[model samples]
Target: MAEFKGLSVSFAVKQKQDVQKQLFWPNLKNGPFNKLEDPVCCVKYCQSVPNFAVASGFQVEIRDPSANNAVVKNFHRFKSPVRSIAYRGLGSGLIAVGETNGHLSVHSVAMRTELRHMTAHTAAVTGLAFLAGVVGGGSTLSAAPKLASCAEDGRCLLWDVSDPQGQPLMEFDLSSASSSTSVSAPPADATAAAMDKATALDASQTDCNLLACGMINGRAYLLDSRQPRPALVLSHEHPVTCVRLAPGDNALYVAGDCWVRALSLHQGGRQIAAYRRHHKHVTDLAVGRGALLSCGLDGLVKVTDLLTYEEVQKYEYPNCGLLSMALSPGEADCLVLGTNDRWLLTRRYESPAAAAEAAEAAKSMSAAMKDPYLKAVKAYQVMPARPEDVVAPGPGRSRRPRQQLDQLDRLLKKFRHSDALSHVISKGQLKRKPQQAAAAMRELARRGALATALAGRPDVHVAALLKFVLHSLGNQDMAEDALPLASDLIEIYAAPRELRARPGIRPLFERLRALLAREIELGKQSAMCLGRVGLLLDTSAAAGGLAGSGGAAL
Candidate 1:
């Protein structure tokens, strides 16, 4: 009998490079009620409303995205610093905030008043989120929402906001279960007991029925609000900074230190994949249609494919450490990022074809607006002025002869370093020829002419050069030669204290740091391999000597 088998199919996925347009709003340097003590901690877009909320220091500010001016109204003020914020129930006009003083407050957007405030935790609240499909249904618009908050105290609490005086509906003690077992173990097996204790605490939830809490002790707990104990635990080497549930899927994405891991909720909370692209702690994550967007202290915003687990696009801002990120609920293409310096940036992606068409149209319009007389002269085949046509030089200096003047003009026509670099980049027309440009720049660096060429260039040109050098340093073929040159160039053009504080300088330094780290890690691994090989060779030689002695004795 013939047996049926399933075939696995795989395809090479081509990356999409979309043209991104960015806009920056003025920094919100001051909080609504007081001077901000820290950068904005959280920014959340309302799914059913036009406004978004930003939390910083002791206040939450609500701002309209469509407004022409950059003004934020003081929505709610707390006694302690607001560490995290989340919007509850679509179009419910309700916002929830967690504070450093371990207090949780729910505020009504339309009423502009606190609906309820409770002592939610014993320590600083690290995360706040509203469970999906728990409130805001039917014709009544006043349904109470359920909230989940986690804290440095290693506990996650679930609260029902139906009554102002009610206590937390449930609490998940992250330390209790594991601590008891370790305490009962024998002293001789202390190490084994500690390991067992850790394994017990690292739990996570696979379904929406449970809330995942990332603890400061490098463990994530999944609490079933209906049950008194945790349902599952997930462990990490570094403290878990953030936890997010994938929309419409039973998967969780956790970010801590420099890594982000995807875990399956249904498969006993097993980790599916881990991405370590960011060089610093991942500050925030926003999941979109088929991609996950992450921002980090390294000043990079990366979009990773959910299925392939590969980075599709990366964006960096100079001197800016991204602290928060939010995707517009109405538009997936619109993303708002908050920086450490209090600048809120919006990035919108447009179709590459459309951008190209717009550029072409603008160029044609400019050409048509040129002097009509010059256009007519060109159309009639009139002879334009040439170097040889000049009879005499201007008042600056004495002119020798037309031939000498022409020779001087020819010398001047030779491209400067910056101009030559630009020409090489543009030679491939719409597509940039990066390899050709990199080769030309490498030659310039070798001749010690790159610095002279870059001396008076605009900031944009310098930024482009920095990007090129970084990319070259990442190439295995060019890295050995490019590393020193790249370092020198960055030190000269980018390392000044004031320059490093510029809007775009931080990311370059971060990329350089990441490259250096990779080099160091490679060197360490190579050394370890060499040591192992030597040990094996020495062992073989000793065994051979012993065998020869034994044979001679026989």
Candidate 2:
């Protein structure tokens, strides 16, 4: 904490909002381990719009970007914790909520009330997916969407989500279905019936005729909306957790215990490509544009290139285990993740056009009518303007202050300690020079928030900070200024094990015996310097005037 003040922050780390959207997730300053923290089981992006839904605690929160973070009109509460949620069509037309009690309810966001409440399963509903295509193989798409849901029992049902008095359109007990008909389950025993429970469901977008559900018995039933029998059965060794069909038609992505595999529909349910990085159970998968997004108990959200099935990028939340993931509709810019904690870790990559629209909206809003979504969006780093966005300013046109939110302040406010420290170190030309880094470091230190910034990070950035401090201390001219920071480092790392074993600490802690002795010698040198200063003071009669900046630093 003290070293941050004296040394330049030439080494910093990078990651984004908790603060990026932390304002809507409840500030992390509320303590990481709250008793009331609810585990978020499901999150679903709207099928036809930008808004999304989060199933946390006993309520399903509908977050709208065009409105407030939580759209009051679309908010729906339940008697039990919501297990899954889905939206029917564009502009939040119809919403479906599946509860832990096996009860599924439909609500119309435009109507602002519950339209139907019905029993869909005997146990907790695991998932609910909307059918985007129409029935009877027509060229026209259905004006009203159909919902496909699965529960703990051997149940997978489809319903008209727009119906006021709801009755399932079709239902399935896929327990008898097997990849090879000869290898069917050995006569449904009590345990076998329960073990073959439906774990996941998905309705294909391009082919309204296609729908699929994964079972705990390691098989996925690719069902036809028009028929009673499954058109195909895809087999896996691990219990299937999630199933997703590509928009291009029939490239199904299935995730199980530790691996994710792509299966082709036209090749007699042939295995196409397999992707595995998850050491634990892969919980959910979402099909994105040219990407297949997945998250698991491994605490990683991976983005795989759709064509190659090669990992494109992965986002890690240090200690958070993810349960569900969704990519927002419209621009598909927002990535919403539901963790095993109360918070929803949302990261949005707004393109240049989106950012400008947001800025324009912010400029139009008055203080009283300020949008909370806009406020939360402001916390994140704004996307840079593209070439197409460049414009020639007209005469007397004034610039707006709508998009200038302080990045470091937002990071600190959200308790993103690691990122705050990184932001400080990344200031100015850190690699070539240290002056700007020192100034930024001093700013953080002045606020007495240095401890928060230096806590809980045990990565390369912290190692870089340690090396920066050690190098700064080697300069006799600068060592005195950095002494406090060095002491703080030892205290923070030693007390919390924040830097248990890092490249930067090897030098500082490896020669502990010699370092201790050298500290004694340094103390002796400091005493000699003070004695000389005292001699200089004696030459004048100014008692306290001579002990200015130099004395202050020491």
Candidate 3:
């Protein structure tokens, strides 16, 4: 069972078990991106209005969510390509646009005219976001709004959009700061090294003062709006493409290359965990109610548990590389994805009839295992007995020396052949008895229980057995004894292509491959040395035979 807060839930209860659903875009009635001019660069949802904005080519189109059949005429066009777009706040219709020409423009959606235009960056601006407090809630729109933007020039600029005539409120040279303060500098290509540093930036939605930026050279920096210097820095092997601060402002989520990593800000920026399920670059991430949503260039959208880091759901869109993603604030299950194919796809979770069928099946399974003795036996076979379950000596009582053995005998009689062997292997390992475990494994192999276990639930103990085999093979004394068992187990468990592709199993395959290669080389060298020794022995024997013949003749 797993506990969350003060509530307990069964581990068998999958996150998506109750919500068996399919995701489809309802707005694709007229076809995907039929009205948009070109491929989408970015997408964002507006809070004040029931519409969404998409930047395609050099135009930013604002469309009504209630009517997705046609595009609205209310859009802002720029002379250069619009790389990024962001809304100021909930009640404010101000839209901020960043262009590839290093130009930043603030426009009013109601007026459909540019209010302020300035050269905020020397290169293309890649990211734009407003401070969390500047948007949402019931806050009045009377105060000036602050916007953060990152550009290819390696600079993160802060602007007071309210005063267009004034200069930038703050400027942070990410490239210079990183070069001077980074503990270990990352290797970069000539072009990337020559470019101005910062590549991406995002303001935290929970804390207005917190901001995060990613550099082209695989570094992520956390910044405080009140301070000029960075608060913390993180490095990755691949270029950092995106960085997002969680809603609590204590966790930072970063995506780069083919990985998504989480860092705990409260723990001085220690990495909490990393998820590498995506096959390509993870382009964006959105924090939902209790899950983290990520989209990648592999056209996979994965939903992972924030606490456990377990992937709960996955959606695949073949041949389409996702570049941007946004979750609807009004709908927890509603998600919008901007693709390289020039389409804005929206997905919403809807319950299906399969959920009812699954529930019925689970109920039947529970009913079948209702017998108390059978249930106990099944449980013992699946898991090792607890330490407290062993009968120990008490005050004024003599300890039963064979209590565990007696219990094992009773279980062995109650269970089937295969089941008994599995129980012995599991319990022996837990009890830290190597000889007992080896004997159980041998019995299982004799009865062909290894194949049965692999087919039934390979995830349960297959990895454990694999690790044990590898350890034994590494030991010079036990390698010969463990060779046959290791070969049989690997042939059964590693035969499936899908099983080999699993994240946990892939590393084991790599290690096995390297170990086998080394052993083959050593075997060749040993064979050559033995051949040389045989030649020397034959020469000495022939010489002794000639000497003996000479002595006999004399």
Candidate 4:
């Protein structure tokens, strides 16, 4: 290995190699999911088997991601649109489904039959899970008959599927609790509203009796079905989109429209940490023993380490928004994704060692490869090689990208400032291309001739220039170069009473003034925050120094 600045480079090289081996390459497993008619809302993997399920168009589909010719089972007895699906735990061969309308269904996988149907709620069912031994003062897994379901009206119902009469075991109205009571101090106007819907629910892996229910109006209700009310209510600023309980820790993750926050279960759902990279709605979350996986409408799938609360890896697919995803248990399997465009995608993950072994095996068995038509063949020239018949190739060429720059430079050299300005920045009359024309303004500003250039422009040309500068000032990347130009333009145009008196230019100048004032206020706030942070650092350093001196004296 080569040394950089006389330092050994072995560690950095090894790190890079490890990263390459861990990277996952994605490929389309099946094209658009044959006969798929609607966007998928849920993709969940069975805890006891390799089969995964997808909810789409009032139907629930079960298939294996690792097989190209896997048998698929569909539940076709739904009377309403399906929203979410989950396999009943304990290898029970049962599945529960929630519908867009307020209804629930339970089906036996082997019998291909509906065991129990529920119509207890009057709004869209958002969350569904089984509470095997955690309901009605508790029982064993085989004897616990309660299945929990919640809907948009914030009503949670526990149904006894085994009781042939089909009556619910208990019902809890989570909306009755104050939305912000769990905090030390909350907003004055915080109250429970009738429309605040229940969004998601999950039970603790270690203590199955504890449940967390997420609501649409930014509240999370911690509940124990044995009681009649929520244990605690946690509040956030955005609607809770999804929630996942950690298997090994007393904490849970809640995803909202913007960020995903981790709340401490032992400390009454207080927010302990958060992660944010998605700029749109975070749609779903899946928790494993050691990692947290999230997919969002921004088309990003993030993998995070549960122990450190740090991002491990992320993949961004710009063309499609992901609605849900399921990670198979082992690395040998593949990841299944449900997209907003009604497409099911899957791809396998391979480590470097596994990939190399596969390559060697294929090379030794090249003669018996499946696609024999793709085999490499020996080739010979059909015609005799002749230098005279082959004409030398000419250099590839295209029109110059900087032709506009040349035209602007020629106009500037002639010192026709107004025509040069118009040559680049006019979108007047009907249409415009200010970007193509910004070249003229940039050159004029560099020469300190912008004032002279703008002296006698008409309303149409002035309007276009003002609009471009306004748009540029709002963007961070272009703001630095635009700041000084904007200052000079405002001084020249706004100070002139005659120009301000004109109807077209007056409104434009007022908007510029408002933007400048807002930017100034924001800058002041940023400076104040920096000062406070600096003071905090200084205080911490002084305390550390005094402690060191005391330790040395002792």
Q: What order do candidates take by lDDT, descending?
A: 4, 3, 2, 1
> Which regions of candidate 4 fall more than 4 Å away from where they truly are?
1-35, 69-71, 89-92, 132-145, 176-194, 329-333, 363-554
Q: Summarize candidate 3's per-residue lDDT along 68-125 as a digit string, tens digits.
A: 4246635656879888888655544778899998899877766677777878577788
Off by more than 4 A, model 2: 1-37, 66-68, 72-76, 134-143, 161-165, 177-189, 350-554
Models 1 onward score TM values of 0.58, 0.55, 0.58, 0.61
Alpha-carbon error at 299 in model 4, in Å?
Answer: 1.3
Candidate 1 TM-score over all chains jointly: 0.58
Model 1 misplaced regions, further than 4 Å: 1-38, 68-73, 90-92, 137-142, 176-208, 353-554
Candidate 4 lands at a TM-score of: 0.61
Can you rank all candidates by TM-score, best first?
A: 4, 1, 3, 2
Model 1 vs truth, CA RMSD? 17.4
Q: Which ten residues in a row have the lowest lDDT in candidate 4?
A: 181-190
Prediction 2 TM-score vs. true:
0.55
Model 4 pairs whose backbones collide: 424-437, 427-432
lDDT of each: 0.62, 0.66, 0.67, 0.68
Q: Model 4, 1-554: lDDT tens per residue? A: 00112324478765663453355433212222433678978887765578888888878888866565154678867888898786654434667898887788777765667877777776678887765353221122335446777777667777776776666777665645443322122123324434467888776655656777888888887788777578877876679988877765487788887578888888887776775546457898876535677888766677765545656665655456789887775442566778888878765665667878989998889756646344323233245769898656546544445645466668778666656776676434113644444545677777666655564356677677777778877878657656766776676556554453457878887888899899999999999999999999999999999999999999
Q: What is the lDDT of residue 70 in candidate 1?
A: 47
| Model 4: lDDT of residue 432 | 61
